[model samples]
Target: MKTRAAEGGTGGVRRRPTLLSNAETWAQLAVAARIGPEAYAAVGTAAEPGTVLLTVNRPGPGPVVVEAPFGTRLGDVLHACGLRPGDSVLVGGYHGAWLGPVDAAGASLSRTGLAELGATLGAGAIVALPAVTCPLGEITRVAAWLAGESAGQCGPCRRGLPDAADALVALATGAGGPAGLEDVRRALGGAQGGGACSHPDGTARFVLSALDVFAPDVEAHIAGPGCGRPVLGVLPLPRGEGARLEVDWSRCAGHGLCGVLAPGLVRLGPHGYPASTTIPVAPWQEHGARRAVSQCPALALRMRRPERGPGRLR
Candidate 1:
């Protein structure tokens, strides 16, 4: 789990200051300074009085970052990104909502506007799912990645996320049936408010929005012949170029030691074995992960750091 640096000096120990703002916030501040507050406020709506930067992703081209005034129509943004109005769009980012065709047609770029559609303009990311790829499959891939990215400090991250990912996988592959969709919902619901951080809540929002936006496609997989389309990996992931935990199944016994040492990264399955082989190692969890590897009785666990350079996401 990532430990947030606390503010203020405690017992005469001065801690290093941590700046919480992102680059976009800094850029916006610079623009507001240059253009003057009144001028900046004049362009956008009264309620949302400033331009926002959007990282728009569509088919054919790489993701593009553009700035637009708040309250710009979502459809216009799609058109500018080489997408049609009716295409399924993932708003915000990984922890954001999915907008169906009708919603996309009427939605605007402001926070209030998106909230009216039961979504949020979170991180100002808009991903338009192209017709060529399978929506459910893409959703499943993201859910799995989100599960892997869990900080693993709480019950929601340790259990709920992995279960939700499993349920989503079942639904996407046409093996989960109607009950599987319900299972996904239940898992997400179980995670809500159970964590100290917003990771679980944000993840639930993302997956639930996907279920709503891709309702027809989800139904097709459950009730009839599945969408037969391939899962073209269009969505961008954090480049896989870091240290991660891996299990050697051949040399291993189902000891469940990794789960004890690194609860956040390793979860035990029904048979008391690590559920996932390749688990993401958050920077804060490295010490625990090393301990788990060193103490594994069967010597089944190992830490693998890729030698390749950091890759970019499109």
Candidate 2:
């Protein structure tokens, strides 16, 4: 396994060279080395041989880590994680698709099997969204986050994604009316390809799948009254690493855009300044917070991800 580079630049071709792979790949190789390839091949399918580490999240306190054979049924995996069959599950992660009850139950943990149902076993993360929370709401929340994650180097990231995300927000809130679906479709189509990175394309895939899998909810929100379910922030975010919004009062010209963008999290005082310079942003509100910071005219608002304390290294 010739590696691209070593600690420095690609080490000039040597008689004997060090092999390089990701931590997971190296770890799996170690297992195969210890047990031998023949024994390792006996576990999973022929094509996708050996076991996979899955981070399974059901309607529980925390995620459960399990090593499952590649060809295992997703239903069985969910059951092992205390999820019932026919539950709505987010296969893969934010970039992945949503599988309704039927699809989720019939899906397999294999790459080929999951691909059949229009999903990939991305990072082996399977999340069973709770029934109490709104599926559309969760999708909207993630869409906003994805939109905010754009690097802004490409047209799709700079324009299309945020537009699509706004449409999604409008759709979820029942504000887009009958044109909601069309707006989302148009924006997604524009954002689908030709990006500097895969962010736009992946986000489109995620939003499209969510719309298909949760069509009933989409119809309800668009035409009917509502699902009456709250966005409980069920999906996990890396926000625990610490993040917040800071307003530079000196730079702020009291534009009041932050308040309008993130109304709940940021409030405008009588003088039109933010009630507080520092705003604690929740995982669900992070997208809105980001939008507020970006849309701020004076550029006073900025995101602050606090530095994590160093842990004791043994």
Candidate 3:
């Protein structure tokens, strides 16, 4: 992996101190600065006068990046890039949502246009998911990648993401029951808030939207042994941890509620002593682990993130 001196501190979200938009966004700004807005607007939409760098999923000729207008029809962009029939287009990058042919046909590339369909033109990257591939398996791989990329700052993010990814894997393999799906949802919810970044939020949005867009396929996988299709790894993932839950004995009454609720993560000392004060939560056990801490009647539980680097995850 490539590493660089972080512009911002080596912690939290938006780690770079610079105003970080997409590279293309910056490039467009530079162009507009050079030619002035009036000249730049000559070729683009009046509302958002600029071009976007559109990238494709695979290495085929159709998957190449193209400069497109702000008001260009999504269908036109795909057609220019050689989008095939039955291919689902994922607008935006990894965290972006996908659009089926029918949806893609009428979609526009503008931010306002995508918003109408509850999508965003984030990063201006579009990926075409081939119909032959198993969508869940593809999603599962990306989820794992996202889990691995955590900054290890927040409570749920450090622990919950792995479980979320695991649930997706189980679902794709048909080993996960509906309960596993529920587990996935819970993990996602746990990871959504209080994170240093929106990594969890964006990932959850992508996966949850998948559940909606591909409901029939999801149901089929649930009902059957497998989707029988391969996970082509159409989406890319950058390899990517967080915190522990500690209880203060002075405040903890050893209610044993935590142990009872999430026994896998917490246990009471002999005679409900709450002897073990620290519970190291794995990414997979984040939800129940947090629940155990929150439900403690004593309200002594707290998150303990490392001062630097990853701890157990490393």
- Cα-based TM-score, every candidate: 0.76, 0.74, 0.67
lDDT of each: 0.82, 0.78, 0.71
RMSD vs true structure, all candidates: 5.8, 7.6, 10.9
What TM-score quantifies how close candidate 3 is to the native fold? Answer: 0.67
lDDT of 1 by residue, 1-314 (tens): 11234434333225444455788788888889999989989988999888889998855668889889999998888787778744488889988898887788678899999998888898988888877788888888788778767777888887788789877877887778999899999999999999879999999999998888889889988986678889898877766645778899997799888889987667677788986676666566788899999999999999977565665211
Each candidate structure's count of clashing pairs: 0, 0, 5
Model 1 alpha-carbon drift over 4 Å, by segment? 1-20, 241-314
Pairs clashing in candidate 1? Answer: none
Q: Model 1 Cα displacement at 70 (Å)? A: 0.8
Assess candidate 2 and give its lDDT.
0.78
Candidate 1 contains a number of clashing pairs equal to: 0
Query: Number of clashes in model 3?
Result: 5
lDDT of 3 at 151: 61
